[model samples]
Target: MSRRCELTGKGVMVGNNVSHANNKTKRRFLPNLNDVSLMSDTLGRTFQLRISASALRTVDHRGGLDAFLAKAKDAELSPRALKIKRDIAKAQAATAA
Candidate 1:
């Protein structure tokens, strides 16, 4: 996978660094990405993602991951992770029952 934030769509930006003496060099500004498992207060479950800190901040600002997730109605998620979350929910429901 590319070095990108799944939440904010942040990726490496290519640019040139110019010095006062007119010396130019290549540079890259990397996104602030972090892997975290966030529990959804609404779903009553957890999901992991490689998201940027800014996107995480937006989630926190809105309320939590749930709010962010709700807003991200079209966001993509890994199939394996989705299956794991579904299985966990099923198990929890079985236990509760």
Candidate 2:
């Protein structure tokens, strides 16, 4: 697909590469993305996602995928991620109800 993080919404950033001669060239800084399968405690399933390294660290720090998704804003999540988030929410609600 695209060069973007499915979790953190990290994408390519554009900047100028400056040379010693004061010449500037366009450059792109891409996020460190990796394909990972994260286990969701609520859904009890493993979901594969493409996410940035930093986002993966944050997920670990936050405890797990479920916890991270709970804290993540809807605006930042991709359509696929958002669907997963909704599924988790529905599962949790059903269990609680």
Candidate 3:
């Protein structure tokens, strides 16, 4: 699988690694990604996602998966996450109506 966070779209960053001799080599700063299961209250389901550590923390801080997705931008979400977001919205709307 690609090294990208499915939630926040965090990806590898390019940088230079400098040595003591002033030599620089290209390096990649990869985001710390983990496979996590987050529960969505609106959909009443758990989603398995590959996300960055910071994004995981943000999810918890925002209350849960549903809350985080509500605040997340569509451009930053993966296709799977975008689908889940739509499903959650539909479920919540169904409950409201």
| Decoy 3 TM-score against native | 0.97
Residue-wise C-alpha lDDT for candidate 3, range 1-97, written one tens digit per residue: 9999999999999999999999999999989999999998887778899999999999999998999999999999999999999999999899999
Q: How does each model score on TM-score?
A: 0.69, 0.97, 0.97
Where's the lowest-lDDT run of ten residues in candidate 2?
A: 1-10
Candidate 2 per-residue lDDT, tens place, 1-97, comes to: 9999988888999999999999999999988999999999998889999999999999999999998999999988999999999999999999999
lDDT at 20, model 1: 100
Question: Which segments of model 1 are wrong by more than 4 Å?
Answer: 73-97
Question: Following a full C-alpha superposition, what root-mean-square deviation does model 2 have from the true structure?
Answer: 0.7
Candidate 3: count of backbone clashes, pairs at least 3 residues apart or interchain: 0
lDDT of 3: 0.94
As for lDDT, the candidate ahead, 1 or 3, is: 3
Candidates 1 and 2 compared: the better one by TM-score is 2
Model 1: per-residue Cα lDDT over 1-97, one tens digit each? 7788776567899999999998999999988889888777645768778888888888789887655655553445345434544555566578689
